[model samples]
Target: MDYRESLSTGPEGSMQAHQVSHFFSAVDVARRGRWDDDALRQLAHLAIPEGLLGPRGNLVRADVTLAQARWYLEGLVDYAAFEQDESLRFGRLALQLWQALVAQNPQIPRDELHEVALKLATVAWSEVRARRIRHRARMTLDTRRTLWFRELDPRCYLCGYKFTAGARDRFLRRSRSPLTPPPLVDFTRPRTKERHLLIEIDHMQAVAEGGTNELDNLSLACGWCNIVKGRRGSIFDVDSRPIGMLDHPTLGWLSVPQPMWVLRIVSMRGRCEHPSGCSANLANSELLVAPYSSRGALNPANTLVFCGEHDPWKDERLISRTLVV
Candidate 1:
């Protein structure tokens, strides 16, 4: 194929063009049933670059030429017989293309390349797998939440806190007594450990590095773990270090007593109260206060806890009931 049209202007343009030319030449050689190691070696040589570092020596996105080279290498491998040495040769060439891409962009982790190369070498690519991967990528946030909850249950995978229905109510009741003053959790305090009951859908493999949305690649993580795992290969890489308390105007550095369960509720549904009543026994409803947001806008003060039952007054008649906590 005439791949010259894929060329673009850059400091590496000329060198990349030469590499593409050599790659196509090798494709022609392979098509003619000629076993030429010298030509293949030249192809491999094209895969290696010399001191062509990207800006700030950081791994940037692969250029058009590199993308084209990778595509062609994958095609060549697919066309070759898996059991034949030619197939292995093309696979190695494809692997080298990724290496060259990474070499130029140091920010791209080598493990990512290794993972991709292994898949290519094994001819593990399939239409079904691709479709599944794409589907996962396209899944809505709500759908992901449903799927994660159904598959893993409501407890967090990391901290093992069961964040099931009514779990928050139980936690709230246990933290304080009816005769005593309501206990307050300090929201400003730095969370030293994972809040097990506040669950989040975490991408075990980050989507940035081509991680699929498949269930196997997804995990139920607590809010703390998800934030700490940001873009890293695994959660283990993150140090279990304590975060310092953040100072806030309403919530002082260490004096504010914000309940953990209340914070979890707020995080899940901002400023919205559960309609089932804040009382322990009546706290079984998932329904929040009607017109969750006020005046087509978010008003933090409007948020109140309510039971799951629909509020006929507010929902149907548009009359809101104020709950005095």
Candidate 2:
């Protein structure tokens, strides 16, 4: 029997499954979108091949032929017909298409172009293989998601909007399939609308930016916020800082490092991270979690929270030991 993927239904789950495979070619594979914000309003119909997101209905991206792009890629490396590795096939194709799109921008050095192209290609491969990747570790993924959902039915870590449970289940279900285009929901309406009410979990650190699946690297997000936040990925930020911000309730405004930096800043809400139950409050503010020595970059995988009293930073020896490098 032949198998095929299905498009999302209009909230009814009755969409017919066609063996449709779209040939996506883009002028900006990484979606650099390098124009002024006003360009969106002023030039809505422009097709910026060098530095923009989509073709703006001009289909600037769709014009590139995948076969021609593949030929260009073959010029760069040893041509491999019927390459056994699926990732190798798709990734190089993505790179070639990026090169083809950037043909007019000859000022970009080939080395720099190749580096960025590979980064973008890697993201595509991760998403394309997300189902298979998750299936390999589905048990662990589901367990973490289940436990995470049980604790938070309150507020979005990013926007501080209070919501109900079950979004975890919804998001997990959605993750099992290919990425879907958002519904034609008008976001300008009230926050209580169906789109605004849906909550989804997001990576505190992006996959393209070397973020892992550790607990510290995950946070709850409203459906809309997650889409807006995760849209550009880390392709824009060179320093690993998130381009998104959170207008928190008590904190006024906070930079969304993990979408839940508000909660993380308080060090597990001012409690000790001890394995055994400890009534001690985290008063010292200075906290520590390991995989310690990095080249000036913090790793969210080993992040921990604590309140004020546990001044772990005071211990010069413990601090030194935690530094792996």
Candidate 3:
């Protein structure tokens, strides 16, 4: 009536189970290379401290001993091998050992222990694959629980630049070449079906200025122009007025601000020399011709995009809002 005999597998499942358990324990507790009964017996020679030894059969607390640390490291290597080899015989045994380890001490953190169990379970699944054995998780998206969730693919709204979900997914589902940038070529006027110069589309209004992602918002930008425009508002000729901050695709023209002459008069303290009329603000760099306008009213229609030094030459009212000191 011994309870031990009732739980014993007696012969068949016992030897294979013993072989797998020995392998897992040797790696987990011993930190040794692959399990062989002969190798394990040698590892056992590395004595466990008498104080740290427990009676439940020879396991040591990983928290305190070098032996336990070695075992954990070796166990990970062994788990990784089993995972790669797709061998479940060793994995099932490993899982039993993990469960037993958790049950032995309630003080042991369960979440960390569960992480080890998951590694073993996943390793077993891989081993099943290696052995050419059939398994339930092999099929793709078999059910709702099985379906993997991911964010909708990201896209650059302004330039329509696209990126991949991840490195592996990129390989499996390599997407087609993205829509090319609008054509930059300019063919002479009389258009023929086969001979028209193509123009690439760009954001007509700046993307940041309350622009929508719709096609109507896009316009053609030549390679030359796009490079010049860069990310900033377009530049204007030195002679142009600050009020015309518009860029024309038809003529490849852009209007920007020009610096003022009074920039040379920056007082020793960095304040504008002519503080009364200009507010020290420059259209390009100079005081405004008319200082009545506030920065809130500045824009494509009135405000000019001028460098700090060049702003003074512009209509004083047309200077940047950035310099309102």
Candidate 4:
């Protein structure tokens, strides 16, 4: 039967069965000592398109692609030693092709690709987690301390209480002073069971969940919040309401009672300010001042909103001249 006809006539479950059957048959051939350049090339022809292409010759649905990738990788996880390596080779090739498909198709949402990558990374979950921890540890003590204080303001991002100086000093000494001898403790004070400020660098998306170790993925959270948010992803429980006001430099605190969601969509889709307002849509624009940073911290101080065409960050002079004034 033609591939297209097979796809249409067979139920979805049956189509998936055919795909898996073809995949494992290819894998089994590789298991037998037939795994070679020509063998792999032929298998690639069968597997890559079967995994990626839909009945209409376009990429498969994101959900279908994700499911197939997960199924194949799970199979790799169970393989015996020699077979495991060959299966891994096949899995990596499949992933590379999927990535290429994502790149070629503008309609494909990148988030779906990221989700797939995250799933594949789970095959070596412990290694990825360890690597991420090591990567974070490799940051200079000074850099880490600076980022902690600057980004977190000596306070927990989740809870607003300021970290005590003693707590801060102890944290710095323990975390940064790797070479120095441990500081002597003063046992005299009646140590009440107060919550000492213990800060942790958290991955907002989590390393195990395919979050990168990039600075953009890192954020400050107290030990309490970090522990609570462990591996389940960020807990955005904090209120995001716009406090019914905006602090304009010239206008002072104007009572702008619009909800943040309304403002964000309005900024993206709203008309320009020119007398004969340009018809160009700013639907894809970011807020001049993001309500939240990419790392997920709220930024109420980000008062200036802008469309894609009029980015405040790009035009520093415009920000100073117009927004500041």
Candidate 5:
């Protein structure tokens, strides 16, 4: 942590700032010193945020095998740092140092960071030195594996190990260029509208039974259908056309084929959710209106959209419709 001895004036000699080169040299000396965990912890706490540490406390953990610490430090330098005026030999040396550490680190096992950087640097150098042969396939696979783990669950389904979200995001941003856009609907839409519409995608077929994960398999169901279908194949009749299920995305209150009667009902009633077991009380006049009528059909296309819940007094009615249906 005390870098006083590590400091020296540059060639012009006016109290030279410690360059990354100087920091790395000091770190090598520190790694050789017999510093306890408490001393290492203090060094990490003081050094990292100021950008003195390479990243992930790699320099501070002197007890860690030299090979492992070097891998992380090397991986930290990417295209942006590569663009700087630093020597090209520096990058090459850093990666080589990391590879040496990987071969040497026993306490801290070689992790994915080492594997990726080694592969990428190897391919990059080969392309530059060996007549530009295409060797990006391995790099692409590694990148894809990184992305899948980010989007999918982090812990291995078979084995449990914590994965960092920050690491995933960094990998995604670097590997895929601009990361994939956020979800389709922004959750921050204003609540003041007359009817706030909630779009939920219901799978046409349950994914558990050979259904592919794609946009086509998705259908926008209103909040009611989304809640009702939770984690189970929705109830469908003998023809395989879903019964007791709303065609949420494509046909709102009516079937996908578009029944004329249902469409007319939906046009007047907005999206209707006749909660299960509620016999249509034709006697209730207040319940049947622009955003809350029971007359809408079960098709996806005819389903209503953008209707915010406006009337406070009718909150009970809205919940009943969406939840029970």
Candidate 6:
């Protein structure tokens, strides 16, 4: 009855998901790996019901001996790792979700079941995020500050995802910029407060940590970044360096000793930066930023910008990139 764990991944949009294929590949891999396991292989001939892994399935397998039942459930777990339809991803995640619903409405038809589930899932999630969302919903950034930031269209301080654009037309009207501050909103509009597309006014210091609403203590982030940053005492603990390179948390050993290289990075401005949607703009940055230096390829995410004076050697930053082998 040995059970093991596995990591799970989804499409790019899953996190900030990129392309991923059909989930069935997980079953393909697991079944392929288990091709030689005798008892497990025999169950494919058992023609387990429509949902071999659905709720109440334990009832159907009650007659099978301990070994048969063990491998049967184990195989379900393996296939679930790749996101089997109607099965938990791993470790029976969302345990008894459907069971709880059926407890109240035993005869609910199959067609209407998912519709009811959606309502429960939707409302339950609002309740799940309710407390955290409540705090920010009560407040909105000052319009004066928003207007200033609107002009800049700042990227999320954490993940650097873009916020939704504001209404601005072309020609006779002004064009929409990469960023435009959202109209004043509050708790009544939770999406505006928490949706990743809009800017979130996160405390540089968390309110739970006794941080305040003072201007300097606030920073911009997409809703996704703000949510992950959560109620942490300081904003610096997260993975991404939202404040830009000079302040990368654990990369202090990083340095560009040559002043000429430092000046060139600042001069390139955004030449190394891969713009949000423009693939054409992203090419060999080495040709653009530095053709001679080969320490490694530059990533736009780690590109430095000149806000003011700082020591190039001490203040310089580097983002690690995994070169595909």
Worst 10 residues of 5 by lDDT: 186-195
Candidate 6 structure quality by residue, lDDT tens digits, 1-325: 1111111333221221111122344445547667566634554544332232232233324423444633533332232332324332322322333445556567887547556555544433332332232344234435325533444545444433334444222111244344432443211111232243545567766654445566666666545446655753221233222222232244332232222222223323433332332222112111123212224322222333322122132232223221100
Give the per-residue lDDT of model 4 (tens digit) for 57-146. 221234346556545654534323323243345345446545654666659688777676555545544332333343333455665576
Q: What is the TM-score of each candidate against the true structure?
A: 0.26, 0.27, 0.16, 0.29, 0.16, 0.24
- Candidate 1 lDDT over 1-325, as tens digits, reads 3344334443542346555455677667655645777655555555433222322111212333545654655553443343233224445555654676566657878888777666654443332223233333555656555655465345444333345443333333333322211133223212333242345667656665457777777766545545545554321233322233334333233222122322223334432233443442121222333223333211222233343244322332221111101
Q: What lDDT tens digits, residue by residue, belong to model 3 across residues 1-325?
A: 3434533635422233344454456556545544557756656664432222222112113223544543554454454444455444655645765676587656889878877767655544443343342222222222211212221432222222222334223222343333232222111111121111122234555443334434455433322233333333322212334434433233233333222211111111132334343333221122222121333222122332222344443333222222211
- Candidate 3 segments whose C-alpha is farther than 4 A from its true place: 1-77, 90-325
lDDT on C-alpha atoms for all candidate structures: 0.40, 0.41, 0.34, 0.42, 0.35, 0.36
Q: Give the per-residue lDDT digits (tens) of candidate 2, residues 29-122.
A: 2234436454344334433322122111122233234334544444444333313344556656566646754684688887777776676555
For each candidate, how many residue pairs have backbone atoms clashing (under 3 Å)? 19, 11, 29, 1, 24, 8
Q: Using lDDT as the measure, name the better of candidate 4 and candidate 6.
A: 4
Top model number, lDDT: 4
- What TM-score would you give candidate 6 relative to the actual structure? 0.24
Q: Cα RMSD for candidate 5?
A: 25.5
22 Cα displacement, candidate 3 (Å): 46
Report how far off residue 170 is in candidate 5 (Å).
Answer: 25
**Stronger candidate by lDDT (2 vs 6):** 2
Error of 1 at 185 (Å): 6.6
Runs of candidate 4 with Cα error greater than 4 angstroms are: 1-136, 174-196, 234-325
- Model 2, position 154: C-alpha lDDT score: 41
Off by over 4 Å in 1: 1-138, 141-153, 164-198, 234-325
Q: Is candidate 3 or candidate 6 better by TM-score?
A: 6
